[model samples]
Target: MTDQQRAKPLRALVYGDVDLNIIDGSAIWAQSMTQGLAAAGCEVTLLLKAPVTTDRLVAPLDGAPGVTLRRPYEEKLLSDLGPRGLTPDQAVTLMTRLDAEERFDLVVVRGRRLASIAAQFEALAGRLWTYLTDVPQNVAEMTSTAVSELTDIAVASRFLLCQTEELRCFLESAVPAACGKSVLFPPVVVVPEGVSGPGAPSERLRLVYTGKFAPRWNTLEMTELPAALDKRGVAAELHMIGDKIHRDSPEWAKRMAKALEGTPDVRWHGGKPRAEALRLSAECDIGLSWRAPEMDASLELSTKVLELGALGLPVVLNRTPMHEDLLGPDYPLFADGDVDAVADTLTLAADPGIYGEAAERCRAAAARFTLEKAAERLRGYLDLAHPTAPAGTDPQRPLKVVIAGHDLKFFTRLADHLMSLPGLEVRLDEWDGLRDHDQYRSRELAAWADVVICEWCGPNALFYSQHKRPGQRLVVRLHRFELYAEWPRKLDIDKVDAIICVSPHYASLTRELASWPADKVVTLPNWVDDRQLDRPKLPGAEFTLGMIGIAPSRKRLDRGLEVLAELRRRDPRYTLAVKSKQPWDYWWIWNRPEEREYYERVYRTVQRDPLLAGGVVFDPFGPDVATWLRRVGFMLSTSDDESFHLAPAECAASGGVPAVLSWPGADTIYSRRWLHDDTAAMADAIHGIVSEDRFDAARLAAKAEITGNYALERVCSLWTDLIVDGTVPEPVDLQGAIAA
Candidate 1:
C-alpha cells in the first residue's frame, strides 16, 4: 500500500473522564473529537470512565461507521466505586485488556484523571497525547517524571498555553522536550450545513441559553434579562436548554427555579441531546453565555459560545480577553455579565441591521473552531516525535518563583516582569483558600517553588508555612487590611524567610504584630508603569480633585467628601470625582451595621446638600486608572491609615499633584510638605496650587518624583535581586525609606 493508503484507517483510542451522554462541555468535546477523528479516516474507540447515565440521553454513537464506544465500568459499578468514577487501577486494567486484544496506534487522553491512567500504560507512552480542558495545575498534579512520559499535550486556548508554560516552569518538567508537540486548539463543535442567513426583524427578540444553571454561570441574571427587557418596552423571550439546575449545585438550582417560576417569557426545555440542542439554538435570534469571569474563565474558552455561533447565532457573552481573541475587537454584542447589560445587548440585537452584522461575524468566528479544523491541528502536533529543543538550565537553573495571593493584579504584573527577567521562572497561585481548599494542590505548588511569596497574610501564607519543603525560602507580604484581620496573628512566622511590606511604616507595624525577626521584614515600594500613567491633563483639570477607592470606611471617604464640600464652597468648579464602586454596591461594607450607618450618613449628606450633591461625582471603577486621573488636577489620599497609598503615586505619575491627608502612616509615604492636617487644610492646599498658577510646576514636580522613585523598571529590578538572587538588604528606618 502507498503511504497515504497505509495512513488511512489508523486505529485510535479517545479517553475521557466524563460519560459520552452527559450534557456538559467535556462530554460534547469528547464526542465531537471522536467523530472528527473518525471522519479523518481513523477507526476510533472512545474509552469513557463510566457508562451513560439513565437520566441523560445516550450519545448517538452506536453503530457508527468507523467508531466504537466503550466504558471501563457500568453506571451501577461506578456508584459502588464512589464519587471518582473509575480508579486508575481499573482504567489500567481495562485499557491493558483492550490493547492485548488489538494494539492501538495512538492514545488520546482527555482530562487529568484519564491522563494519570494513561501515564501508567507504559506500552502507550510513545503515542500518548493528553488534552487539558481545565487549568493545568488543577488538572495535573503529576511529578516531572510522569509529565516527561507524555509524547504531546494539547491545550484548549492560548491562555491555557501560557498557563501550561508557567506550570512546566514551576515543575521543572520536560515541557521543553515536548515543545512542538504542544498545540492550542480551542473546544470545537460541528458547524451546521447551509446555515440560514440572518432572519428578518421580528417584533420580539428571541434569546437562548444552553448550559448549567449554577450560580457561577450567572443563570439567575440570565433568566432576569427578559423581565428587564419587558420594563424597557422591548418584547423578548428566553429559551433555556439545559437541566433545571446544575447537578453540582442543587441549592443554587432550587433558588434559581423559585426565582424564575414567576417569569412568564422564560421557557425551560431541560436537557437535550447535542444535535437537538444545536437545532434549538438555530431557531433563537441570539445566544447567551453571560457568566462571572472566575474559575479559569479567563484562560479557558467557553465551548457553549462556540456551539451557539456554529449554529449561526450571535452570542451575548461577557466581554473578556479570551472572547476578544476569538471574535474581533469590535464584536458588538458583548455584556458585562449583568442582567441590564445582557438586556441592553439583546435590545440592540433586536434591530435587523445590527443583528445581521453580528450574525455574520459570529458565524465567521465560529468557522475557525470547527471540529475538522481542530482535528487537523491535532494531527500536526502528533506528527512531531521530538518536537521542541530542550530548554537550557546552565549557570544555576532559573529561580522558580511562585506568587500565592487572593487579589493577584499587582502580583500578576510583577510575575510578568519576573518572567521577562534573565533567570526567573514565575508561576501565579491565585487561590483565595476560602472557596477552593485543595491542600494537595497547594502542597504540590509549594514543593515546586524555590521561593514562594504569599501576597496576603491569610490562608495562603498559612498553607505555605505548613507545607513548604526544606531549604525552600518563604516570603509573606502583609498589606494594610491584613493587619486588622485575625490571619496576621494566625500566620506561622517561623517558616517565613522574609516579609515584604509596601512601606517602612507597614514593615514596622508588621514586625511589631507578627513574631518574625525584625531583620526579616523589608520594605519594597509598589511599582507603577510611568508610560501607562503620565497622560496630558484635561482642560480645566486644575479645579478637579480625584479619589480612587471609597467602599471601605478606612478610606475616610466622608472626610474626602468634607474636603470636597469645603473646596466647592471656595469654587463650584472644584469638583470631587470619586473613581470607585458606589458604597451601596459593596456587600462587605453595606452588610455591616456600623459601616452601613456611616455610608448612609455620608449618602444623606450628598443628598441633603445641593453643593455636595452637584460637586461630588461618583464614577465607577474602570481599568484605565491613568486615563481617569488625567481629568483631575490633584489626587487626594484622605484615608484613616495606609501602608503605601498607590492612588497618590499613580496620580503623581499622571501629572496630578498629590494632596495627602495626615493619617498615621501617610507621613511615612508622602512628603510632609503635601500632607495636610485636616480637610480644610487639604482644600486650602488645592486652592493655593490653583490660585498661585503653580499647578503646572507642582504637577511636573509630582511626576518627576514618582518617575524617579517608583518607576516599573526600577521596582522590577529590586524585586529580581530580592526574589531571584536571594539578596537580603538591611531594613531602613521608616522615615528615611519613605523619604527615599
Candidate 2:
C-alpha cells in the first residue's frame, strides 16, 4: 500500500476530560477528530486518565487510513511541573525530552499553559501545531523574559485557531503565515455504535450530546429540544456523555444521577475511551452544541458536530458564530431566542428527507474541515521553520494566577476570561492548602503571584497544614457547593484577602457556614459573557417553563415540574422544559449501579409524586435558558435548597416573573428572611409580577443590565483591582453595597 493507504497513528491528547469519550468516546470532540485523522492514514495516540488499567480503553477507527488509542500513562502538566509540583525543573526536563524527540507530527494542546506552549512550540515547532482545544490563557502571563523566549519559537511555530472570529482576526494580523484559516476539526475517535443490523429499533429519535458536565453550560436547558421533538409525537432520547464530578471529587461516575431523575428518554454513559464513543454515536441521530456555558473561545466546537456528520445527522446548534463557522452553509439557522423557532426548525428536520438532505450538506461541509484537511494543512505549516528560535526561561515573569484547589470551572473559566485583558497570566498549583500549606512554597506562590484567586469550593486544606507567610492579595469567590464540605475550621482565615460570592445569598451563606469574620466575605455576583446574554427574546413567547439543574436535592426539578403540571392543568397553554446531562440508554445506566440507583430513586420520586403526574417536560440544555424562560409567563424555583438560584436570577433578568419556591431550610445563610416554602407566597409573587407586562419587560432589560455587570469585564476588573491594589476591605454586608 502507498503511504496514502498505509495505516498511521494520529497521536492526540485531550489534556483533561470531556463527556464525548466517556461512553463510546465519540461524545468527545477529540475522539472524532482523532478518528478522522486516523482514517485519513494517520496513527492516533490518545492520553486519558482512568481509575484502573483503563476499562475497555482500546478502541477503533473505521474505513479510514489510520489508527486510534487511549493511552493511560501519558504525562500531565502536574507530574511534569515537579516531582511534587515544587519547581519547573522536572517539567522543563520533560518538555526538553518530548520536544527533542518530536515523535508526533502534530502536538494539539487542549487547555493552554504558557509554560507548556513555550516548552513545545518554541523548542519543538518543527513537529507540531499549537492546536488549542480551549481558548488560550497564558499569553499575558508570559513575562517579558518569557515573551522573548517564546518570541523565537512563537515566531517560527505554526498557530492553530480555536475560535472563528479569532481566526478572522489572525487572517488580518501579523501571524497570518503562522496560522492559515485556522479551521477546527473535532478530536478524532470513531465508534460506529458497534451496533449495526437487527438492533432493537427505539421509538424515539435518540438525540445525544456528551461532554463535560458543568453549570454555566446551561446544558440542562437543552431538555427543551426533547419537549419540542415530543410535540410531533416523536419520542426522543437524550444522552449526556461523560462523567460528572460530585462535590469536588473526580469520581464523576454517578455524580449526575441525582439531578436527571424522573426525566424520560434520557441516560448517562459512565466513561469510555475516545474511539468507543464514536461507535455509540453512530447508532443515534442528531447531536447538540450551544456554548451558553461561557464565552471563553475554548468552548468552541471540537468534535460533536463532526460525529453528527459522520452519522449523516443534522445538528441542533446554538446561534454562536463560532459554531456557525463550522456549520458553514450546511446548518439550518434557528432564530437566536425562540424555542418555538427551534421547535419549528427541528420538527422539519425530523423529516428524513429534510434532515437527510441537510445532513448530507453538513457531511460535505465536514469534509472541508475534517482531520484529513487539518492534518495536511498542519503538515504544510510544520515543514516551514519557526520565525524565531528558542531562548531560555522568561525574565520579566508573567502575572501569576495562583489557583487554589477550588472552583475549577469558575477559576479556570475566569482565568480564561481575565486573560483576555491586555496583559495577564493563569496558573494552577496543587500546593494551595489553607492549614497545611507548605511554609516555603506557599510563600513562593503567593510572592510570585500577581493575583491570588480562590474558588468558594475545594478539597481539604490539609495540604496547607504547614502554613506560612502570606504576600500576594487573595480573592475568594464562593459557589453554592462549597458550603457543604465537612471541616470548616481549616479554611485560611488570614490568607484570604478578598471574599467573593456569585450571589448575595452565596455570600451570606459563606459567612454563616464558614463563620469567617463578617469583614472577610464579600459578594461579587456571577456573570455570563456579554455575547451569551444578547440573544433577543422571542415574540409571542409564552407557555415555556424551564427548570434546569443536574441535582434534584438542590435544583428542585420535580417541584418545578409539579408547578408546571398544576398551571398546565388549569390552562392547556403551558409547556414545561427540563434539561440535564444524564445518559439516555437503559443498558448504559445498568452498567453504573450508583447512577442506576440514583435514576431509579429519582424516577420513583417523580413518578409517585402526585403533584407532577403529567406536567413536566424536558428541553435541550441551559444555553438558551433565557429563551426558554421567555416562553414561560411564570418561572418557578421550587428547590428544596439553593446556593443562589442562577437560573432564577437569569430568568428574572430575562423579565420572567421568577417564582422562588420558598422552603424553610438553612434559610439564614442563603434565603435570608424571605418567605420559605409558603405556597401562597409563590402564587402571590407569580401573580403580582406576571400582570405588569410593561414593567416586566423593563425588569427583564434591567435584569439583563444588572446581570451584565457581572460580565467578564466587570468580574475581571474586580479580580484585577483586588489583585493589583494593595489595601483591601474585609468582607461586609454587600447587600446594599455597589460592586464593580
Candidate 3:
C-alpha cells in the first residue's frame, strides 16, 4: 500500500438519542462533537434515533462541514418504545449494512439504551466507544452477554468515573463477564472567532443569561438580579436569551415575570439560532448560570458557562467544585443559586473595571475547553484504549498545596496560579466558622496539607498553627485589619514557619506589634494580576476620582470629601466615586452611638454641601473594581493608615493616577510625589494630573511601580518557593528587627 493511501483519516460513526436540530443541550453536544471530530481529521457520520424535521423553532445546521448526519429510525418508532426506540435486531441490521458499505473503524454510541444494543454487535465490539451523557443506572441493566462484548465506556465528567466504578463493582458481583471500562470526555464547543472584546463600561450595565429556564436551572434568581441591582441605584437590565418560558413549566415563567414587574426591565428574546444567541451574549456585560445544586450537582458540567465564556462574557455561576475547577476558587462572582446571593453578585459585576477583568479571565479559561482541545484529549484517551497503542509512562505525584482561609479573594487567585504549575495539587479550605471559633475543619485540613497557608491571622491561622503536625510547614499571612484584631496576639508564633505581610510598612508594623521573629515576616505583597487589571481608561476618567473601601472611620471618607470639594471648586467636572458598602448597612456599627455619630456627621455634611450633592456618587461594594477604576482619573487613598493600600495600586493598574493622603507610614507605601501631607496638597496632586496633561504619565508610573513590585506572578512565585522548596529566610531576633 502507498504511504499516502495508508494515512487516511479515521472513519467513525456517532450515534445519539437526540435529534440534531433541537435547541437543547444534548442536540448541541451531538452536533458540536461531530464537528469537532471531523475537524480532528475524522470522516464522521452521525446516527440519530429521531427523524429530521423542518420546524421554524429548530436551530438550522446550514454549514456543518465534513459530517454526514442520518436518522436510522422514525418518530413513530419513538412513540411505540419511548425514547430508546430502535430494537437490537434492527440496530444490528442497520450497522451491518453501514459496515459492509464503509468498513467502519469505530462506532461511538451516546445513550445507555443505544449503547446496550450496540454492545450486542460482536463485529463492532473491539472498535466500540460508549459515551454516557447521563448517570450509569441504565448501563448496569445490560446483560452479561452484552457486557462481555463492550470495548470502552466514556463519561461527560470525572465525577461519573466513581459512579461508573460503583456500577462495575455491583455488576462484577452479579455477572463475572462484566468488565469495568470508563474514561472522562467532557462536553466541548468551538470557540467563536473574533468575538467582541470584554464588555465595555456603560451608563447601564447589561446582563445576559442563555439556557433553559426550568426551575432546576434557577431562572427565577436570574430574573430577580436586575431588580436587586436597581434597588442599589445601579441602573441595569437583563437580556434573557433562550426559550423565555420553559415549555415544561410555563406557569413558573408567568410567576417569575409577575414578580419582576415594576423592577428593572428584562427583555426576553425567545430562543434564537445558536450563533445568534452567542453573538447577542457577546454584547452583554455579564453572563449568569446559577442553577440549583440538586441539578447535575455531582457529575455534569454546565455547558452554558463554557458557551458564555467563549463568547467573551464573564459568568456569575453557582459555587461548586466543577466551577471552581474551571474558573478557580477566587473567581469573584460565585453564589449558591440564591436570589439574594445572585443579586449581590450582579451588583458587584456592574462595575466596568471588575466586569472587564472577569471577562478576560473567563475568556482565558474558556480557551482550555475548546473543541480542538477537547478533540485532542479524546484522541489521547482513544489512542490509549486502542489495541495496538504503546504503553505510557507513570507521572510524578502532585504537590499538595493547601490554602486555608476565611477571606479567599487573594488566596483563590494565588491557588489557581499554583495549580497551573507543574506537579501541584492545590485545595482551598475557606473557613466560614471563624466567628464561631470552630477548629474541627481547620485541623482536618491542616493534617491533609504538605504546606498549609493560613490566609488571615484569625481562627484558621491559630488552629492550624497549634494543630499542624511535624514535617508540615505552616505560613500565616496578616493584612491590615488582622493586625488590629486580638487574633494576632493569640497566634502561636513558634508554630508558624513564616509570616507574609502585604507591604514593608506592614512588615515593620507587624514586628513592632507582634512577638514573631522579624525574619519570619516576609514582605510578599498581595498579588495584583496585571492581566486582569490593566485596561484602557474610560472617557472623562481624568475628571473622576475614586475611593474603594470606606466602611471604617480610619478610611477617612471625610478627608476624601475635602479633597473632592477642593477639586470641584476649581472644576465643576470633578467628581468623587465612592465604591463601598453604606455605613448604615453594618448593624454593629449602626447600633453603636459613637460609630453612628461619625456616620451621621459624614451623611449630614454630604447632605448640606452643594458641591458634594451631584459630584459625589455612592456605589455599593462590588467585584469589578478594575472596571470601576477605568472610569476613575485619580485613585484617592485618604485612609488614616494602611498596610498595602490595595485600592490605589488597583486603580493605577487600571490606568488611574494615585493621589494618596500622607499618613504615618504613607511614604513607605507610596512615592513622596504621589503622597500629600494635607487634603489641599492631595487636591493639588489631583489637579496636576488632570490639568497639566500629566494624567497618562502619572497613571503609567503608578502602573509601572505596581507591575514591577506586586505582579501576581512574582508574588505567587515567592509563595511557591516557600511551599515547594522551603527556601524562606530564617527568623531574625526581635531586637535586631526593631533596629532595622
Name the top TM-score candidate. 3
Give me the displacement of residue 547 in model 3, in angstroms: 1.1
- lDDT string, candidate 3, 1-740, tens digits: 11132236668777666655445677677777677667666678776655555332223333456677555555232334435445655555566667778886677666656665666556776566666545333444555544443322221111112112223333333333232234345667654467664566567878887766778777776777777778888888888876545656678867766644534478877677777777788787788777787753445666777788778788888786556766878888887746777788777776777788777788887777787886775565433332121112111566676787877766766765665554566777876766543466656777788788888888888778888789888888888878989999998898888898877778888999997788888877676767546655656889998989887788889999999899988999999999999878888767878877888899899999998878889986755565466678888888887777888877877777778887776666566667788999989878877788988777777777766666666676667677777666332222331232
Deviation from truth (RMSD, Å), model 3: 18.9
Cα lDDT tens digits, model 1, 1-740, are 11262324568787766655557887777777787677666788887776556423344566678888775555242334555566656665666677778987677666665565556556766566566644334335555554544323322111112222223332222333433233454677774576442464358778888876787788877778888999888988888887647657677767788765656898888778777777777777888887786633345667888777777788887776556766877888888746777788888888888887777787788788787787675554333221111123222477787888778766655665665443566777878553365666677788898989888878788888988788899988787877878887887777888888988788888878776688888888888767556556767899998899887888888888888888888788888898898767888778899998888888888889877867888876755465567688888888887778888888888888899988887766666767899889989989988988999988887777777778776776677667755676443233442355
Question: Would you list the clashing residue pairs of candidate 1?
Answer: none
TM-score per prediction, in order, is 0.47, 0.41, 0.50
- Point out the higher-scoring one by TM-score: 2 or 3: 3
- Which residue runs does candidate 2 get wrong by more than 4 Å? 1-399, 430-447, 457-470, 484-486, 512-515, 538-540, 582-615, 619-635, 652-657, 663-702, 726-740
- Measured by lDDT, the strongest candidate is 1
The list of candidate 1 runs beyond 4 A from truth reads 1-3, 53-59, 71-85, 136-178, 191-201, 247-250, 260-262, 295-297, 385-740
Write candidate 2's Cα lDDT for 213-306 as tens digits.
6544545555566776687677777766666433443443233455455456666665555445555665677666554524434444446566
Clashing pairs in 3: 352-627, 353-626, 353-627, 353-628, 354-624, 354-627
Q: How many clashes in each structure?
A: 0, 108, 6
User: Using TM-score as the measure, what is the rank order of every candidate, best first?
Assistant: 3, 1, 2
Which candidate model has the greater lDDT, 2 or 3?
A: 3
In order, candidate lDDTs are 0.70, 0.49, 0.68
